[model samples]
Target: MPPVAFLHTHILVVVLFLVFFAIKAVLLLLNKRDTLDRMRSKTKIVDIVLGILILITGGYLLFLYSGRIPTYLIVKIVFVLLAIPLGIIGIKKESKGLTVLSLLIFLYVYGVAETNSLAMNKEEPSVAPITNTTTELPVKKAPEEITPAEAAQEEILNAMGETLMANAKAIYTQVCATCHGEDGGKGLGGAALLTQSQLTLNDRINVIEKGRGLMPAFGSQLTPQEAEALAAYTITLNTTN
Candidate 1:
C-alpha cells in the first residue's frame, strides 16, 4: 500500500479502538450489567480484534522508521505499554479510575505525535556573528582549562545543533516519510531502501530536486536550504542503523 494510505488505515483503526474502549468504560462505570451481559461475548471478541489491529498497524509504521526515534516517541511508547494492561484490567475489574487513566495516557501519546512536527519548527534559529573580520583565534587550551562561560556557550551551540537536526527530521517526516518510510528503509512501492542506498549527497539532492519515477520533484515545494537540511537528515537513516 502507499505509505500515506497505510498511515490513514493505522489512524482509522486507532480511533475505532478508542471508541470501543470508551463504550466499555461507560458500560462498566454505569453498572449496565443487563446490557453488558447481553453483548459481553461479542464485544469482548471485537475489542480483542481491534486491539490486535492497532498493534499491527502501529508496528508497521514503527518498522518504517526503525531508528532515530524522538524522545517524545519513546515516552509515548512507554505510556502505551503501561496503558494497555491498565485498560484491560480496569474494564475487567470494573475500575473506572484505571480506565480513565488509561484513556488519558493514550491521549497524551496522540497529542505528542500531533504536535511533534510543530514543536520542531519552534527551535531557536542559528545565530551569526555580527562582524566577519580576522579575529585572532584563541590558542588551543587543555579541556580542563575551559572557562565556565565558554563551556556554557558550547552547550548552547550544541543544543541549537540538536534542535536543527530535529527540525530536519521533522521536514523529512512531512515530505519524505510517505515514500521513504519512517526509518527511510521502507522501500515502499518499489522505492529503494534509503538506508541501503549508495547515492552520493549531490546525487540525492539532484534527484529530490528534479524528480524520479514514481516520485515527484520537491524543488518547487521546498527551498534549497530546506531540501539540503532534509537530505542531510536522510543521510542519518544509514548512520543510525
Candidate 2:
C-alpha cells in the first residue's frame, strides 16, 4: 500500500483509540462502574486490535522516514508507550487519577504530533542573513587579447554552469519544495529557510548530503556533484531576494 493509505489508516485508528478512552474515562468519572465494565467487556478485542494497528502503522511510517528520526516524533512515541500501560492499569484498577493522567498524556502526544514540536508551539521560523563568501576573481586577459581556444573554453564553462543551475532547481522542486517551499521560507516540518540561511556554500552542501535535524540526508539519492549544484542554487535564493 502507498504511504498515504497507511497515513490515513493510522489517523483513523488514533481517533478511534482516543474516542474509546474518552468514553471510558467519562463513564468512570460519572460513577457508572457497571456501564464501564460492560463496555470494556464488549470492546476488549477492539482495544487490542487498535493497539496493534497503531503500532504497525506507526512503525511503518517511521521506517519510511528518509531523515534521522525527529526529536518530536521520538518524544511522542515515548509518551504513547507510557500512556498505554497507564491506561490499561488505570482501567483495570479503577483509579481515576491514573486514568486521567493517561488521557492527558495521550492528548499531549497528539498535540506534539500535530505541531511537530516538543513544546507544542507553532512559532514562525526565523531567517538569518547568509554570510558573503564572494572574492575577486583573478584578472583575466582582455576579450580582444584572448585566444580563440580560451574563448571557446569559457563559453563551454558558462553553458555548463547554467545547465547545472537549471538541474538544481528541478531537483529542489522535486525533493525539497514540500518542506522548504518554492522560495524557501515555508518552514513546514521544521525545514530551514534557504533565503535566510547563514551557512557558507560548502556548509550547505554538507548539510544537504548528511542532513541536520528534521531534514533528511540526500546522499543516497543525490550525487556529490548534484549536491554541490543544489547548494549553489540555494545560495541564489538568498541573493535573488
Candidate 3:
C-alpha cells in the first residue's frame, strides 16, 4: 500500500490506545470514594506498556515512511511527550480537568495526522495540454475551388522521384546533419564512436524509435511522418559521398 495510508493505520492504532487510557484516567479521578489499590496498580502498568508500544510502532512507521517525514508527525510526537507528564500529574492529583485536556490534545493530533496523510496520498495533477499543436494544422482547400489561373499554376508533385529526393534532402539537413555530419563522415557525438559495421538505415531507425544505448526513444516525441521522412533521408546519406 501507499506510505501515507500505512502510516495512518499505525496512528489509528496508537490513538485508540490513547483514548482507552484517557477514559480510564478520567474514571479513576472521578470515583475517588472507592479504594485506589487495584485501580492504581493496573492503570499504571497498562498505561506504561501501551505507551512503550506506541513509541515502538511510531518509530517503526518513521523508518518505513522515512522518505517523507511530515511536519504534522513531528508536532504530534511533541504533544505525545507533553501528554506523558500531564497523564502522570492527572493520576497523582486525580484531576478530571487534566484528563479531559489530554483527550482533547490527542484528538487534535489525530486530526492533523489524518489530514497530512490524505494530503500526501493525493496524486499530482497533469500539466500537458489536451491538444498537440505540432501534428495538427488547418488543411488548405484545392486551388480548383478558386480562380482558373490559380488552378493552372498548381504544378503536380512528383510523389515518387524528384519530390521524394527534395524532401529527403531537406529532412537530412535538418535532422541528420547534427549527428551524422554533412558528408556522412561519422563526425557527430555518437556517430564518431560507431564503427563501419555499426548499423544500416533500418537498424538506425529501430534504435531511434526504441532507444538502445545513450539515445532516448523518439517514438512518442516524433510523428510517424517525421520518422518515415528521417528513415528515408538516412538511407541516402552516403549514396553520393
Candidate 4:
C-alpha cells in the first residue's frame, strides 16, 4: 500500500475512536437516564484494540515506507499520550474540560499527520554541476589557422556540454532513483527508467530540459549541451550487456 493510504486509514481509525469516546463521555457527564444504565457496560476494549492497530501501522509506515522516522510523528504521538490522561479524566470524573481537551488533541494529531504526509510528495531539485573536483583534463590545442576567438568559443561550448551531463546525472539520482531505483532497472523507486519506451534519449533530453508533470525543468539551470550528455548517460543505464 502507498504510504499516504496507510496513513489515512490509521488516522481515520483514530478519529473514529475519538469520536465514539467523546460522545460516550459526554452522555455520561449529562447523567442521561437513557445512557446511564448502559454507560457501565461501555468498556473501551474495542477502542484500545483499534488504537494498538493504529500504532502498529503507523510505526511500519514511518520506519519502512519513508525509511526514516519523521519528527512530526514523534510530536503527534506526544499529543496522543497527553490525550490519554484527558480521556481518563473524562471517563472517570465526567469532566467536560477533559473531553474537550481530548478532542483538541485528536485534531492536533490529525494536523501533524497531514503535514508529515507531504514529506512523501516532495519534488526533487534541479541538478547542479559539482565544481570542486581536482582532476583536470589537458585541453587540446586548436589548429594554427584557426582564430583565437573561434577556438575560445569551441572550448566554451565543450565545457558547457560537460557541465550539463554532470548535472543531468545529479538530477537523475535525485528525481528518478526513487522509482527507477539507483541503477534504473530494479524498478524499486516506481518504474524502470531503463526499460520504459516513452523516454528515448532525445525524449529524456527534452523532458529534462523542459520537464513534464512531477519533473522540474533543467533548461533554466543547465546548459543544453549538459542536458544532452546527461540524457546520453541515462541511455547506458541498463545497456551493460
lDDT of 3 at 197: 22
| lDDT, candidate 3, 1-241, per-residue tens | 5333444455555766776665666567668525454566666667677677777766765565423455656787888778767766766677777877776677676665544432334122122211111121111555456545323222211122445546655665665555445544433222322222234445656765765422346678666656654554443332211
Candidate 1 lDDT at 191 equals 48
Off by over 4 Å in 1: 117-241
Q: Give the range where candidate 2 is weakest over 10 consecutive residues by summed lDDT.
A: 130-139
What's the lDDT of the predicted structure labeled candidate 4?
Answer: 0.57
Q: Please state the error at residue 113 of candidate 1 in Å.
A: 2.3
Per residue, candidate 4 scores C-alpha lDDT tens digits across 22-136 of 6776686676646743643565676677778767775765454323444665677788878866876666666677877787777666655543432333222223222222212
Q: How many Å off is the CA of 237 in candidate 2? A: 14
What is the C-alpha lDDT profile of model 2 across 117-205, one tens digit per residue? 78977544344533322311111578688767545533433444666777888898898877677776666544666756656657888
Better of 1 and 2 by lDDT: 2
**lDDT scores in order:** 0.64, 0.75, 0.52, 0.57
lDDT of 1 at 40: 59
User: Model 1 — TM-score against the truth?
Assistant: 0.50
Sort the predicted structures by TM-score, highest score first.
2, 1, 4, 3
Off by over 4 Å in 4: 1-5, 33-40, 65-68, 115-241
Model 2 spans > 4 angstroms off: 124-241
Ranking by lDDT: 2, 1, 4, 3
Model 1 lDDT per residue over 1-241, tens place: 7445666687787788788777777787788967655665678888788788778876776666533666766676687778888998887777889988998887776666554421423122132211111112122568898767545533432333555657767777787777667776554433445655555456677778866644657889888866665655665555221
> Largest lDDT belongs to which candidate?
2
Q: What RMSD does each model have against the real structure?
A: 12.5, 9.4, 21.1, 15.0
